[model samples]
Target: MPMTVGALRETAKGERRVALTPETARKLVARGLAVIFEHDAGREAGFPDATYVAAGATPADAADVAARADLLLCVQLPPADRLTALRAGTAIVGQLRPNAAHDRLEALGERGVTAFSLELLPRTTRAQAMDVLSSQAAVAGYRAMLIAAEAAPMFFPMLTTAAGTIRPAKVLVIGAGVAGLQAIATARRLGAQIEGYDVRPETREQIESLGARFLDLGVSASGSGGYARELSAEEQAAQQAALGERLRVFDVVVTTAAVPGRPAPKILTAAMLEGMKPGALIVDLAAESGGNCVATVPGQRVNVGGVTVLGPLDLAAGAPLHASEMYARNLLNFAGLLVRDGGLSPDFADDLVAATCVNRVGEKQPQLI
Candidate 1:
């Protein structure tokens, strides 16, 4: 008999993406996995109950889906209440933030449920298909640039019109990760004069490849995990001074610096905002984990020294349909690696799964908190 997999309705506030779509359900069915999904799980994201039914999945209630599932899949981490429904030995896969919610992970471990966090997948060439963070951040970066462009008073492209020639906006992107690189490319496509800064000296080629000048502050604070490491107070001061000096010339700034388990580093100070041209715009993508800008308030827009700062939370949720599609593909790739021969065979020996799996293994205690 095949293992039973369930897709529960997303309970996270403002999260509309379903864990599985009808098309994905059909693929699982063909692979000999029984699928059960809560009725209307995908409705808000434009997939209807009838669609799942046509794809050979049973439309179940939330309780039934949770009770019957041998494996549960979700977009966000399950809430405390939902975690209570899992049977011992049940496997759960999703974007559970273990670093941010160690207590919740401990609870799941106590319940004897195997949990996997998609974000912890290593950035290896073999794991590219399962790279949810990069895929989602790509969309976020593109959208953030558009948001900044719209909010700014000046035009992104230089226009030689009959009335007068409008100068192109200057855009500065901090952090040359997936989001930052996408922001630079998107801004350049809009004809903006783009410049990018990063603690990783290796990203200089990447920044220049996107037609953006790479701003170097002579810092070597990047980590082995290919992320920006925390900087020393003295190094931070030098970075701040260099960044503040550049702020005065840029018409739009987008900050994407973030450390997964820690608060976002403050790269833009209040004084930096003061130096920005009047009516300038700043989009801080790290708002949810504190912000890259000191003035940023998550999910709110603030004005400082005549400059507009937008701290948008869950930018991926803003584009539900496409976001769901990309996320679903990532999950499917990950599941494919673990599920084989009509049963769950989570290969702990596999590097990708070993790095991503976060819950208790066998009788061992959880690795996190």
Candidate 2:
């Protein structure tokens, strides 16, 4: 019998993106695997049930899909209560943030369900096709700039009107990762004067290529796996002092610096907020992971001394259609490693498979291979 793969409707509140798209489902079916999804799972993302049916996917009840499938795919982790419906030894793949819910992970492990967390995918060229983090970050970054532009008092572009000439907004994006680069590009497209900064000096060229000036903070924290190393206390203080002076001059500030499983570094302080212009705007992309700004409140916007600070949560979720498409493709590519010709089995020796396996069936502890 062929291996069965299926997806359930995401149950997380306000989460609109579906785990599987009809386009990706068709590819899996072509590979000789049966594809199943909960009815109306893709409706919020604009793909109706008819679309999945046309693409060779069966739309069924959520429980039936969970009970029948050998490998379950998801966008958000399924609720803990729902795991009891899964058959023993069923494999699951998703972001599955281990840090957020150890109890749930333990429960799934004890149930003998194998879990794969894509967030742990190594930063290697070979893994680029399956990089959900970068794909979602691009969407978040692009939307963050628009969010900043809307909240700012001044216009993003310069205007030459009867009222003399209006100056363009001065924008600064901290962190030169995929999201930061997209933010810089979007801001530039909006005619803002953009400047980008990162602790990695190697990013200077990338920032320059995007037509944004790169700020030299005289500090480098380049680390393994394409992430900036955590700065020492002295280094953090020095960086804060130097950045505070420059930050005050920008009309819009967007901070995207973050490390996986770690609290975001505090870059903007309360004193710095008081120093900025009266109507300056700040968007903290690291808000969910404890924020890079002192005034950021995870999912709320607050005014600190006349300056507006926005800490957006799940910005990618706001762009449902494209985000779902990108994320679905990423999951499909990763799933390819485990499903071959029609059977569900993984080559434990493959680095990608080994690195992503959080918990296998019957294991007492997670194998951080």
Off by more than 4 A, model 2? 361-369
lDDT of 1 by residue, 83-122 (tens): 6777887788888887777778777877788888888887
Q: How many collisions per candidate?
A: 0, 0
lDDT of model 1, residue 265 = 85
lDDT of 2 by residue, 142-232 (tens): 9999999998999999999998999999999999999999999999999999999999999999999999999988888988889888789
Lowest summed lDDT across 10 adjacent residues in model 1 is found at 360-369
Q: After superposition, how far is residue 259 of candidate 1 from its true place, in Å?
A: 1.3
- What does the lDDT read for residue 281 in candidate 2? 94
Candidate 2 lDDT:
0.90
Task: Using TM-score, give the best candidate's number.
Answer: 2
Off by over 4 Å in 1: 361-369
